[model samples]
Target: MSARIGVVTFPGSLDDRDAARAVRLAGGEPVALWHADDDLGGVDAVVLPGGFSYGDYLRCGAIARFSPVMTEVVDAARGGMPVLGICNGFQILCEAHLLPGALIRNDHQRFVCRDQQLRVVNDATAWTTDLTAGQVITIPLKNGEGGFVADEETLDRLEGEGQVVFRYEGLNPNGSLRDIAGVTNERGNVVGLMPHPEHAVEPGFGPDRAGAPRSGTDGLGLFTSAVRSLVSA
Candidate 1:
């Protein structure tokens, strides 16, 4: 059976449909989950897509963290359910304490939108199993407060534990510490990244590579990896 992947839609979410489409393209069934509902609809995995939830009020993802649906997502994630957060959703994961560190304003103090190159630093995570360590992939990244910051100790711990999943390959758009673009929980079940993988899952819509045509569909691996993880489990 196709894996059922839940894509949560908050009031201000902009990429919920894109995430669902990505899941469907990856050969999984997409289940639309609502922020007001406390149920996950028995999905095998969940994706918190990129968007300015709650208008990014107070702080990025600060208000959305307490939404009723997040309670269930937290519980399910703790039970080893695969959770992937992208861009604004990454902020939500950090706010929910599912992931460590916080996203701050870009060091350049400007909203950045570009085709970012990222290296797969750790392939053990549920969302990155199909990638090999050191492999570079291009994906769309668009955010204002996308810089990742944490205490020195926390950064060390993440590095020491091999939890840093993806790192910026070329120019760091947000000035994230250590050029970190993504990280995963210790169990490797939960992953969060500042890039929008859902937007890079399709051919014409994805980023363009240097020596190739606009064939950058590397983001498809993320969703397919989740399906593989669920099937293997």
Candidate 2:
């Protein structure tokens, strides 16, 4: 049987459909979950797609953190439900205390959109099981407040515990502290990142494949990784 993955659609969410499509393309069932609904509907996994939830008012993901669905998501994640948060979703995860640290305004104080190169620093997470540690991949990254900020002690803990899952390979677009682009919970079931993997799942639709060798569709591995982990789990 195929794994059922839930994608939450909060107000002003722009990538919900794309995330759902990626899940379907990866041979998993995509279940649309509303922000108002508390039930996850028995989804095997969950994805919080990137977007300006609640119009990004009063800080990105701040208001959305109180959504009814988030209560369920938080509980499920703590119970090892395998939650993946992308961009704005990552912000929500932090605000909800599911993930450590917080996302602040970009260093440049401007919105950035580009094909970002990242390294899989930790492959132990459920959402990154298909990748090998140190494997490099390119994916779509667009955001305004992508800077990850935490104290030195927290940073040390994250690094020591191997919670830093993805690191910026080349340019740190948002000037995130320690070049950290993604992180996972201690159990590796909940992950939050600033990049958008759903946008790069398709061959032609993703980043160009001609210029670089074996780089296009780098985002497909993320979805496939989650599906594979869910099945095996």
Candidate 3:
């Protein structure tokens, strides 16, 4: 049976459907999960898609962190179920303490929207197993508070433990510390990133490459990776 991946929808989520579509494109079943519901409906994995959750009030994901559904997500994530958080979802993971560090406002003090290039520094995460270390990929990224920050010790631990999964390839769009674009938990089952991979999973509708119009699909591997990992497990 294909893996069932749950996509959470908060009050202000804008990419829940996109994430679900990406899952379907990757050969998995997409299950809709609600913020108010305290259950995950027995999904094999979960994705918190990018969006201005809770209207980005009181700090990006701070309000959404307390949502009833998050309690179930947190518990499931800790139990080793794969979880991928994107953009505002990354903020939620940090606020929920599912991942270390926080995403602060950009150093430029402005919202950013671009096709971001990232290097896969660690391909061991459940959502990145299809990537090769040092490989570069491009995806769409848009966020206001996307800079990742943490204490010196935590940074060191993440770097040393191979938890820094993705890094900005060249330009640090949001000035994230150490150019970190994504990270994973110690167990590598849970990951959070500022880029929207779901936005780039389809050809002719994703980011462009080599002057081609909306032809890039580098982001598809992330979803396929998770599906393959589940299948193998």
Expressed as tens digits, the lDDT of each residue in 1-233 for candidate 2 is: 89999999999999999999999988899999999997999999999999999999998999999999999999999998989999999999999999999999999999999999899999888888888999988899999999999999999999999999999998999989999999988999999999999988887788775666554578888899889878876
TM-score of each: 0.97, 0.97, 0.97
- Estimate candidate 3's alpha-carbon lDDT, on a 0 to 1 scale: 0.93
C-alpha RMSD in Å of predicted model 3 compared with the true structure = 1.5
List the global CA lDDT of all models: 0.94, 0.93, 0.93
Residue 194, model 3: lDDT of 97
Off by over 4 Å in 1: 210-214
In candidate 1, clashing pairs total 0
Model 1 poorest ten-residue lDDT run: 208-217
Which regions of candidate 3 deviate over 4 angstroms?
211-214
Name the TM-score of candidate 2. 0.97
Residue-wise C-alpha lDDT for candidate 3, range 132-152, written one tens digit per residue: 999988999998899999999
